[model samples]
Target: MKKIFLLPLISSLLLFNCTPKETLDETFQKINSEVLANSKAYATLGEATSTIGHRLTGSENGAKAEEYTYDLLKSYGLDVKYFPFEVETWMRGDVEVQIGNLNKRNYEVYSAVSLAHSPVSADVDLEIVDMGNGLEADYAAKPGAVEGKIALVYIGILPGSPEGTSNLHRSEKTALATDNGAKGIIIINQVDGGVLLTGTASVTGGLIDIPAVCIGKEDGLALKEILKKSKKRAKITMTNTSDQIKARNVIATIKGSELSDEKIIVGGHLDSWDLATGAIDNGIGSFAVLDMARTFKALNLKPKRTIEFIMFMGEEQGLLGSRAYVDAALKDGSIDNIKYVMNQDMSGNPRGFNAGGQKGADGFFDKVGEHIKAIDSVAFTNQNSNSAGLHSDHQSFMIQGVPYTSPNSNLDRSIYGCYHSDCDDFDLVNEEHIRNNVRFSSMMLYALADTDTLPARKLNDAETKAFLEGNGLKLKLKIGGDWRWED
Candidate 1:
C-alpha cells in the first residue's frame, strides 16, 4: 500500500477529534499486515474441501459441513449459533446420453452432464430440435414442432445480441423451451474445451418438469453442425434422488461498542454444488468472512456497530438458508437491526467493492473505495458498482429493502469455466486472492459498521420497489417469481 500524502490531506486526519483519520488508516494497515502474514482462510478452506468435501445442501456432506463450520466458529471464541432450515435438495444420479447417427447408430455423448434439479429418473428417446438461442422468438418459430422434441440451444446469447436485445438467463431459456412444449432441453456451454458445468435448470430451484442437460462447447458445436446437415436424434437416460432436507446457517457476532442494535451482516453460502469441493464458488467467500472475524478478534478490534459473520447453507438450492434467515428476522422483528449486508459470493480477488443496495449508494461506496485504495492500491481502486444480481446470498437481503455489497472484480470470468464443475476445487483458488479478500472486505465491513454518517440504511417498502425498478432487477425478480409488488 502506497500512502500518497498531500499537504491538505494531513490536515484531514487531525480534523476528527474522537476517531482520527490516522487511526482508521492504522486499522486498515493492521488488518492487511495481519492477513498477509497469518491468514487462516486458505488452510481452513483446504480443510473444508479436503475433509468435508462438497457441501451439497440436504446431503450428508452438507450436514457435516454445517456442523464443522459451527464448531469452527465456536472455537474462535465468538458468540456462535446455528439456524436450521429445510429445503428441497436434489442429488445427481447416473446420467447417460447418446446421439444417433443418420443410420440410427448410437454414439457417445461426450462432455455432458444433467443440469441440477432436473427431473429424476427420466428415459426418453426424443428427437432433437435446434432452436438457436432458444429465445421467445425462436420458440415461436417452431410452434407445435417442439411439443415432443428435445430443444437444443446455446447456454448464452448466440453470436451476441443485436442492439437493444435483452438476453434472458439460461434458466429463463429453459423455462421458455419447456413452456413452449419441449420434452427436454440441451444447452450448449459457451465455455470452450471439455469442461462441463452444472447449474440449476429450474428458475424456482425445484425440479423442472423436463430433463435439461449441458453439453461442452466443442461437443455442442459438432452436434449443431451435424443437426444442420442431417436430421439426428438423441437418447437420454437419467436417475436422480431428491428430498426435502435440513440445512443450517452458521452465525457469529462481534459485539459493537456503541449502537449495538444496529447490525451489519457479512456472509457467504457454505453449501455448494456436489460436483466438486466448491472451493472457489463459496469456500473463498465464506472463509474470508471467517478469517476476517478471526483477525478482528486477534487484533481486539471492535467497531461501533454489531457485525454478524454468517455462513449460509443451501444457496445453490435457491438461497434457502438466507431466506430462512430473513424470514426469522422478519418474524422476530430483528430485521430492523440490520443496516447493511456485504455478500462475498464468488466475488474474490477484489479490485473494489460493489454496493448492490436497493437504492443508489455510489457516493458512499466511492468514499469507501478511496480509503481502501489509499491503504492497498493493488487490491482496490476507484471501482464501485451499484446494482443487484441474483444467485447469491445477498439477494435474500436485497429484496427486503436492505442495503447490500459484493466485491467487484474481473477475475470472475477467469473461473466461469470451472465455476460449478469438478474443476472447482482447492487447486483453482489463489492464496493471495483469499488473503486480499480477507484484508479488503474486512475493512469494508468495519467501515460500514463504524461510519456514523454512512448514507446507507434500510429502505421502506415503496422505496425498495422503486430501487429494484431503477436497478433493472424488476424483470429478473418477475422471472424468478420473486416480485412482490402489485399494481
Candidate 2:
C-alpha cells in the first residue's frame, strides 16, 4: 500500500510540473485562432491610415495622430501615457529656383524639406560648383571652399547594380555638404524625364544649418549646358524658419499576470512627410500594432510578461521620438526590464516581410519566423542588420543593448518604388499583408510574454554565418570580434 501511494504522488508531481507548459501552448493556439477569426482587424489599419492621414513631425497633424493612437489604445482597456520631448521645429516655406541665360524661365523644382533647426536664408545669388557625386574624394578636393556658394550635387542613384535599393549614401552626401559650409545645395534627380522628386531632408544630430532642394533631371542637364556655354551662375532664393518645438511619444501598456516585470514593446512612428497624408508610410504600421493591443485585451488572455505599445512622433524628422524615449529610459533605468522590441514601420506592401536584428538574436528571430509561418500569410527572411540599432525607433533600444526586430518587405530595385515618396498612400496597402503582419506580431508577442524560458542569447560565428548564408543576406558584421562568446 505504501509503495502504491508513493507512485501516485510522484505521478501527480510530474503532471503539476507540466501543467504551465501545456497551458502556454493551449493559450498560444487560442490566440492564433482568434486572430484568424477576426481578419478585419486589418481594417482598423485602413481606417487609421485614412482618418489620421499624413502626420509630419511637429505639425498639428502629428499631434492629432498621437492623440488618436493614445485614445485607441485606451479604448482597449490598457494603461496609456504620453512621453513628451523637446525638438526643434522647422516649417517649410515657398522655395523657387531659376536657371540663368538659357531658357531663363522658372522651372518647377521641389524643395527638399529642410532639416529642423537649420538657419533661415532669404533670396541670394551664389556660384554653383558641381561636386561630382559628393564622395569623400570630392569633398577633400575642396574643403570649406563652398562658403556662401550653392553646391550642385548629382544625387546619384544608390550604388547597387540592382535598382531601387535605399540610398543611404545620398543622405550622407547631403550631410557632408551641409557640414562643410555649403550655403545651400541643389541635387539633380536621376529619374526619367528629369521629374523632380520631393522628400523630407532628415538630419540626425541636429538641424542641418543649410538649405537644400532637388531639381528635375532636365533642369540639371539644362544647367550643365548653360555652364558649358558660358561662365553662368544661378540665382536661388529660399525662405525658411526653424525653432524649438514640443514632440511626444504615445505609450500604452497591457499588464501581465505572473512576470509583469519583463516587457515586450511594439510600435511604429506616428509621423509622415508633409506632402501626402502619410497613409501608408506609417499610418498602417501604427494601426496594426494598435489593433494587436486591442486583440490581446479582447481575448482576456493573461500573459506572463507585459506588452507595451508605442506610437512614436518625429520619426520622419530622424526618429526623434524613439531616440528620446531610449535616452530617457536609459537615464531612468526603464530599459533594464525590457525583454525585446518589435517594430512595424511600413506594412502596406503585399510582398513577404524581412526580419533583422543584432548578431545574437537568431534564436528569437527563429521563433518569430516559426510563429509567422504557422499562419501561412507572411514569410520571414533574416538579414543580420541591427533591427534596433539603425535608423528606426528600434535603434533607440539597441543603444541600450536591448534586442529588437522589425518585419518589413524587401525593397531592392525590383520592389521599392513607393518608400518615402508622395506615392506612399492607403490604396497601395494590401489587406492580406496587413492582416498577416498583425497576426504574426501578435503571436510573437504572445509567445514571448507567455514563455518561461528565454530564447538562446548568444550566437557563434558558424551559426551566424550559416543563418546569413541560408537567408541570402549580404550584411557586413559590425560588432567587434571580442563580443562573440563561445557557446
Candidate 3:
C-alpha cells in the first residue's frame, strides 16, 4: 500500500516539474531582449581600442590581440583553440617622398606611406609619367611613355570613364607598372582634402621588385597640375622589413546535440592595418562576433548543427590565416564537412543578408529574413541580395566551393572615408549599429544551424568557375593571380 502511494506522488512531481520546449519565435524574442539589456560588445571594443591599439599581424600588438580574444572566448564557457600557422609577414618602416623638378632643386617634401610588401629598400628618382586609369589599355594608348619613369596612377576609375571600363586593384596597377619597365609607382588617393589610404600593392603576397607608395589626394592633385604645366620628377625612399613568424587564428566552437557533422563558420579578420586603433574597419565586426558568442553561451541554446566563431589573423597581409585553414582542411579531407561560411569584414548595421552566389538559397534566406524582421523590423529591412566579392576571408572558403554569406550593410558615409586610414579609430563606431549586427546575425546563424535541410551544397570545380565568370570576377581573380581555371 505504501509503494502504490509513492508511485502516484512520483508521477505528480514529474508532471509539475517539466516545462515546454521553446518555439523558434520565442527563442528569437529572448535573444533580442537579452542582447538589448546586457550587451557586452561596446564595452569590449572600447577596452580593446584603448589598450591594444593596432593589431597588425606578426607584431607584439598582434599577439596581444590574439590572446585577448582567445581569453574572452574561453571565459564564455565554450570550446576554443588556436589554429597556428607560419607566414612571412611584412611591416612598415621609414619612408620618404619628394616631388618637383629635381634638377632645379625646387622639390617639395610630402608625407607618404609605403604600401605593404614593397621592397626592403628603395631609392629612386625619375620623371613622373601619367598613366590614366592604370589599365592595360592605358599603357597601349601611350606606348613606351612610362618606361624607366615613375608611374602616376589613379586609385579609382575616374568620373565619366568609358562604359564597361573596369578598374583594377592597387596591386594589379602596381603589376601593370612593373611589367611596363617602370622604375617606381605612386598611387593617388581618391579622397579629397588630404585624406590618404594604404594597403598591399603586391599581387602574390611577396615583396615587389620596385618601390610603391601612396600620397594624399590634395598632394597628388597638385602634382598633376604641375605636370600639366611642365615635367616633374618623384624621388621615393623606403625601408620595410619582412620575416617568418607564427600567427594563430582564434576559434570558438558551440557543439550541437544532433547533426553535429555539418558545421557553420562565422569569421572576421582580426588583423588591422597599423594606421590607427582600427575601431571602425574590423573592430565593429570582430567584437560584435565575440558578443554574439557570449550571447549564445549565456542563453545555452543548442541548435541542430555546430557553429564556430573565428577570428582570422593576417588578412590584411593577404588572407594568410584563412588560406592556411582552408588548405589544411582540404589536405585532411575535412573540407567536405563544412556546409557554409558567413564572413564579417568592416561590416556594420546589417539591414539584410547577401547569399553570395549560392544557388537555390534565396528562398531559405528570405524565410529567415522574415523571422529577423519580426525581432526588429526597423533595423532589419529584410532586403536580401545575391553576389560574390573578393579580398576578404570569405574568398578562401569560396574558392574551395564552399557556400558563403555576409551581412548587407549600409554604414555611415563618413566612416568609409576612414577605411585603411589613420582616422579608423573608436570615434567612428556607433553602439546601436554594431548591436544590430550581433543580435540579427546570431539569429540567422542559429536558423542555419538548426534547419533540417540546407538549401545549398558545395559546388564542383567547373561550377565554381562558372559562378565566378557569371559574376564578372574572373578578370579580377586572374589579375590577382588567384584564377585557378584554365582559359
* TM-score of every prediction relative to native: 0.92, 0.77, 0.94
Pairs of colliding residues, candidate 1: none
Better of 1 and 3 by TM-score: 3
Candidate 3 Cα outliers beyond 4 Å, as residue runs:
1-20, 160-164
lDDT of 1 at 367: 81
- Write the residue-wise lDDT of candidate 3 on 1-487 in tens digits: 9999999899988977686657778888888998898888889999999999998988999999999999999988988999999989889998999887858468778878899989999999999988878899999999999999999988998776788898888999999999999999999988877777889999988899899998898888778777888898988999999999889999999997698888899999898999898898789988988988999899998988889999999999999999999999999988888899989988888989998877677778889889899888999999998888899999999888899989998789889988898788999999999998988888888888888887578888998898888888898788777889889
Which lDDT tens digits does candidate 2 get at residues 281-339?
77677777887877788788677888888888887666779878887876887777787
Ranking by TM-score: 3, 1, 2
Residue-level lDDT tens digits of model 1 in 1-487? 2355564576675665546344677888898888888899999999989998998888889889988888887777888998888767788898887888646686666557989889988987778999988888787777777888899998777675565656777788899998988999888888777677888888877789888888888898888999888888888889998887888899999999898999999999888998789998888889889998888888878899999999998888788899999999999999988998989788677887777754457788788778789987866776887777777888888888888888885465667678788789998888888888898898888889888876577888998888888877888888787898884
Q: What is the lDDT of candidate 1?
A: 0.84
User: Which has the greatest TM-score?
Assistant: 3
* Model 2 pairs in collision: 54-277, 54-278, 55-272, 163-413, 194-217, 388-394, 388-395
Candidate no. 3 TM-score: 0.94
Alpha carbon lDDT at 117, candidate 3: 89
lDDT minimum window of 10 residues, candidate 3: 15-24
